[model samples]
Target: MTKYFLQKTLSQSVSVSGTGVHSGKQTHLTIHPAPENHGIKFRRIDLPGTQDIPALFKRVVDTSLATVLGANGAIVSTIEHLMASFAGLGIDNAMVEVDDYEIPIMDGSAGIFTQSITNAGIMEQTAPKHFLIVKKPIKIVDNDKYVMVYPEPCFKITCKIDFQHPLIGEQELTFDRAKNNFEKDISHARTFGFIKDIELLKKFSLGKGGSLDNAIIIDKDRILNEEGLRYPDEFVRHKLLDSLGDFSLLGMPIQGHIITRKSGHTLNHLFIESFLKNKNAWETGPTKME
Candidate 1:
């Protein structure tokens, strides 16, 4: 198999402004190009002391509702979707500066971030791309919920979600990263939540930025949104989207096929943590295809 790696970036810096999903505080996010090998770093501009949080699975300190990364005493929350956009678009180096702990939910999908990054254009850099290649199948399970990664030439995901709600029964979705169809097939699948869970989330002071605009609201029997689903299997597609973002936290593009069922942020992070811990199962090197 041939390896492939390419450094990439937006043509210029672009900023987006919105309210954080959990904090409910207005925040600004700026995406800028960084030097090669810099990977993706998040800078907390709002903190009294400036600190950088490397978007790595190891730095993940929390994965409740969203993924949170902390380093040098600084934390950045809800970064999975943004990282997914970067990974899906083949962006290798970026500096994500944010003024809050969480990124704006931004319609609860990766479409906006993908569109903005595309508008900025992709510029190639000289450095070779680095990739983590899975050499053996690895699996993690928590009861019936599980995630498994198997050797593949390129990044891919197969996700299945089973919800008891009538609006989203059982659905499965797949993505072939090398085909570059992320924007069309996966990006617009919005986040979703049950009506019964709203009050619970609020009690925990979470989902403050959530609304019909950013998430699909599912009641007992049907969807609460006037407009129907974006895709018949949107729920599963959104799960695949979240998997892409969560896996991107590996700090480099991955080469593997991921199979998941009823997995969420916590399970995704567990898979990554296990991958990192079991180095013998994988190896990283310069791409053979430049």
Candidate 2:
């Protein structure tokens, strides 16, 4: 048997400090262990007397630049990376406190967060973990981008991306929960963007903290970073990383197969709404280890 069916949380608190990619502001974030069934919730310590924003799809306020969650006039932006780290590690409950409106974009990947939580160690609770088990297919599409889920005994994700750039033309990767390692295989994939888009974001005062050190920047025909790609298909893997975070807002782990094609945060959020509306397509209960 595996621990996937058991609820878990951090054995102790862990913290990280960095700059928010879009806000260009330094922020401190700490993840504290929570009792069973608490789920992941974020509190903006900068705003006193505000309610904690539950890390769930219904609380998502914006997906234009990143997954932003809001409650009681308080907001937490760029949370997908940290949320992905929680989901990837099978962390069932945590209390994340941040000193700003946005979570820091640590190296533009979940590696640091995952490593911190792993070093602190994960504690398993006696309560059973509930999983949303897909019983039928659910899908949503926007233009040429689409996201879909199918019944599966274990969690799996298949991501595909196609860009006109020479360095990253077309790439696809599949991560099987029953077989793959999330930290080694997926956590280090960094967020990427084109040079032109970065310039435009700067014009709008967005992505002000984005740099080669934090994100993989692409020039017209080359990568702007001094170091090259982490993996041959790092681009698609990063897309997969984003998908993992976006879907984590489902409020519980899913036992299903998710396939995404050219999807981003917006499309992923839309698919989550569709999945929730189609409740008959899935059943919720304790998952059995296959």
Candidate 3:
């Protein structure tokens, strides 16, 4: 007899603290366990009145600078890393409480968040985990950027990138839920940007908390960060990680093969919006574990 995989949440509360990559403000975040099917939510403890924001695709207020969820004048930015951790670890439900408008940008990756969730432990709930099963091919294209989700029996992602830099001309990564280790393979991949872009972004008051400590800085002909690279294709891997986080906003895991090419947050959000509006495109059901 086969037993179905159950939905899971944190066994105890865990916290992470750091500065928001854009806000540059010190932020404290805590993840508390929720009852079965509660899904994931963010509460702004620093806000005046009610400040709860459900981490759903429909509630996503901004994608200009990280995935931002806002409601009732409360906004939480830079949440992709934390959301990635939950999705990567198959955490179905949690109540995230934050003391600032943004979640901390720890190492510009999901590594720290994954570690915290691990330390808190994962508890399985009696309810079965539901997955969004893609029934047909759904795609969104914007000039050279593209995003697509295809009907498949398992969760998988294939990402391709082509940067102008010679060092990172083109990169591709394929992640299979049954074959890939998210924590070691993708969670540690740091966000990256060109040196000139960083300087320009700083002038515009963005990436205030960005540094070598949190991101991989690339020079015109060389690398700025002495650590070199975690993986030769770390940039593409980080994009994959971000996509996972963005897709997590669907409020449940999905069973499909997601293929992306030169897509960023905007394209990712657009795809989600289209995917949701198309009623015949997907259905919810229990996942079959191998």
Question: lDDT winner among the candidates?
Answer: 2
TM-score of each: 0.95, 0.98, 0.97
* Model 1 residue 204 CA deviation in Å: 2.8
Q: How many clashes does each candidate structure show, in the order listed?
A: 0, 0, 0
Model 2, clash count? 0
Q: Which candidate do you rate higher for TM-score, 1 or 3?
A: 3
Instruction: List the global CA lDDT of all models.
Output: 0.87, 0.93, 0.91
On the 0 to 100 scale, the lDDT of residue 72 in model 3 is 73
Q: Which has the higher lDDT value, candidate number 2 or candidate number 3?
A: 2
lDDT tens per residue, model 3, 158-268: 999999889898999999998899999999999998888889989999999999999999888998888799998999999999999999999988899999999988899
TM-score-wise, the better of 1 and 2 is 2
Q: What is the C-alpha lDDT profile of model 2 across 23-123, one tens digit per residue?
A: 99999999999999999999888888899999999899999999999997899999998988898899999999999998999899999999999999999
Candidate 2 deviant stretches above 4 angstroms? 1-4
What would the TM-score be for candidate 2 when compared with the true structure?
0.98
> In model 1, where do residues sit more than 4 Å from their true spots?
1-4
Which candidate comes out best when scored by TM-score?
2
Clashing pairs in 3: none
Model 3 clash count equals 0
